[model samples]
Target: MNVALWIAAGLLAVVGLVGGALKVVTPKAKLAAMRGGEWTQGLSDGLIKGIGVLEVLAAFGFVLPRMLDIAPVMVPVTAVCWMALMVGATVTNQRVGQGKLAVATVMYLAIAAFVAVGRF
Candidate 1:
């Protein structure tokens, strides 16, 4: 179970890191262009970038304390946080009528919730 949790954490971290980095680095115009100009429909660029930063930090939160054997409780805490973020993201996508994005967010949310429970 521990090994499985670690693998899950690594997967989450990789996705979060890459997604967050892209969000941070990519221009709003580019993102908007990709998603039919609806990616940031109701969201400001600043808010989007902030979410990116949080994602990156959350990825670190999942790995750091556990890796250092310090405040290992933070692993589950981070997972919960990640799940909450995904829940919000899913809701937003649904509101925007982005069915595919909502589905993906739900998958991420489920994974995060599973990790949270398994790690805790």
Candidate 2:
């Protein structure tokens, strides 16, 4: 279970870091033009960037506390946060007619659910 949690955390951290960085740095128009990014069309730049920041923070939350053996409880808390984010992503993608993306978010949500239950 420990090893599984580590792997799950690593996967989510990579996804969060890469995806969040893309959201944070890319312009709204460019992001909207990208594949799987149509949902950006309905969101404000500030909201998008804020979500990006949250993702980056959640990435760190998954690893740092557990790695440093400080406040390790944060790992499950981070997983919960990720689950919430994935729920929103699923909804947004569905609304934008990105059914495949919505399905992908469901998978991420599952992983986060696993981490939450396993770690907690």
Candidate 3:
């Protein structure tokens, strides 16, 4: 169980890091210009950046506290946050008819939920 939870947390952390980094770095216009606009549509630049910040923080939270044996509860908390973010992503993808993106979001949400449950 510990090994499985660790794996889940690691996967979520990497995903959150890369996805959040891209959201933080990429220009809003550029993302909106992409096909289907599923990733950035219906969201303001500030909001997107804020979400990115949350994701980045969650990424660190997923690993750092638990790994260091300090405030390990943050692992589950971060997993919950990750699930919320993925839920939003799923909705966004659905709104834009981006089936693939929606599927990916669902997968992330499932993984995050698993981590949350395991850690908690």
Candidate 4:
């Protein structure tokens, strides 16, 4: 379970970091291509970038504090934040009639919630 949690954390962190960096650095055209033009349907570029940064920060929050054994509470906090973000994503996608996205968001949220319970 611990190994699984760590692997999940690492994967989540890497994805968050890479995704955030892309959002921050990529142009609209490139981003649109990557998202198959779906990402921009409801979200502005600025909002997308902002959420990306927050996700990256939350990913760091999941690992850094716990690794250093200082303010380790941040790990669970980050997990909760991630879960909240997924919930928001799920709701937003559902509102926009993006059922696939909503399902994915819920899946991710479930993983985050499981990690939160196990880690904290």
Backbone clash count, each prediction separately = 0, 0, 0, 0
- RMSD to the hidden true structure, all candidates: 1.4, 0.6, 1.3, 2.0
The numbered model that scores best in lDDT is: 2
* Per-residue accuracy of model 2 over 2-119 as CA lDDT, tens digit each: 9999999989998999889988999999998887778998699999999999999999998999999999999999999999999999999988899999998999999999999988
For residues 2-120, could you state the per-residue lDDT of candidate 1 as single tens digits? 89888888888887898888889888878888863475777889988988898998889878889999999998999999998998888888877898988988988888887899988
- Write the residue-wise lDDT of candidate 4 on 1-120 in tens digits: 988877777766776788678777776667767643465565788888898888889779867887898998787788888998988888787776778878877887887887789888
Specify the poorest-scoring 10-residue window by lDDT in model 2: 33-42
**What lDDT score is found at residue 115 in candidate 4?**
74
- Which pairs clash in the backbone of model 1? none
Using Cα atoms with residue i matched to residue i, what is each candidate's TM-score against the true structure? 0.92, 0.98, 0.92, 0.83
Deviating ranges (above 4 Å) for candidate 4:
none
Report lDDT (CA) for all predictions: 0.85, 0.92, 0.87, 0.78
- In lDDT terms, how accurate is model 1? 0.85
How high a TM-score does candidate 2 get?
A: 0.98
lDDT for position 67 in model 4: 83
In model 1, the worst 10-residue window by lDDT is 33-42
